[model samples]
Target: MAQQERGNRSRRSILEAAARVFDERGYDAASTNEILASTGLTRGALYHHFPSKEAIASALVAAQSEALVVPDQPVKLQAVIDLTLEFARRLQHDPVLRASVRLAVEQTSFSRPAQTPYEQSNATILDLLRQAREQGEVLPGVDLQEATSTIVGAFTGLQVMSQVYSNRQDLPDRVCALWRFLLPGLATPGMLARLRTAPLPQTAPQAAPQTAP
Candidate 1:
């Protein structure tokens, strides 16, 4: 048990170090030596876990969603909104997630165009929209595919601007604005009125279901 725990810690340390390097320098410029320097681990230890730089990056990209701090919401559409909002909040603090996002978006430098993070994001949003539609939160005629694509594209652009101007300090607000604009067209009138643009308090207050049909 102790050996397994130590191995887990070593793997986490290597990943965290690599994440910071990737976030700062991008994949092409980051090196295992830099990652190892930050980790204070021997070359053999790093190779014992991740075989190569690309493998380390691939692991980060594949596990990006695991870093999200999504909170539960009774409304499916609200859950989708919270997902983005949580990601926005995460960008301010989590180096691991930021590196994963950088690798996913800068696919030209990091890997092939088909990436795990985007695929996972699309799947998550699509599933939420499907549930929201069935619950009558989403408008009857809105195509979920288009809606999902638009939300993802919009968030991508929004976060880039936020990162450029404010280092993502303003992302939560930007995300809320994005949702406020999108909700009018995408949600049913009743649902639109009930949706919130802010993060819920940690201790949620009991309320009626946000679903409307």
Candidate 2:
């Protein structure tokens, strides 16, 4: 048990260190040596765990995605709003996310061995949008593929900008404004009305059931 716990801690330390390096140097420029220096881990130790820099990046992406899951109870629009705001806030304040995002944005190509997290996160967000559509929450005429891409693009762009600017105070407001404008048109009437009102649910709401008609 102690060994397992120590292993987990070591892995997390490596990831956090990698995030710092990635944020500071970007993906193309970040080096395993830099990550090792940041974590104070030996080359052999790093290889024992992650095996490659790309693997560290993939772990970082997985950590980020896990952190973003919404609650499974009745969700108020305010909760969603708050959740998004918190996510943006983390992207701005969390060194790991900031670095990973910086790495993602700075990359010019989307080749494999480097595309795992990027592809996975995009797929996850698209799946969420598809669920919203099936739940009578998405507006009609919104093409699932296009809307998903747009939404992901907008959110990703926001994170990248926040990381780059580092001088903005209205990020939450900016993100909220963007979301309100874009989400309303895509929501069903019932969902739109609730979202506009920004009602606070007593508890976390269930994720809209995902089923196809």
lDDT of each: 0.79, 0.63
The positional error of residue 18 in candidate 2, measured at the CA in angstroms, is: 1.8
Clashes of each: 0, 9
Ten residues in a row with the worst lDDT in model 1? 204-213
Best by TM-score: 1
Per-residue accuracy of model 2 over 97-186 as CA lDDT, tens digit each: 655565555552354453444565566566666666666666778887786577567877776565457643456666777777876667
List model 1 lDDT by residue over 35-114, tens digit each. 99999889999999999998898777765666543457779998999889877766666666667677777874454665
lDDT at 57, model 2: 72
What's the TM for model 2? 0.74
The C-alpha TM-scores of every prediction are: 0.88, 0.74
The residue ranges of model 1 lying beyond 4 angstroms of the native Cα positions read 68-70, 108-111, 199-213
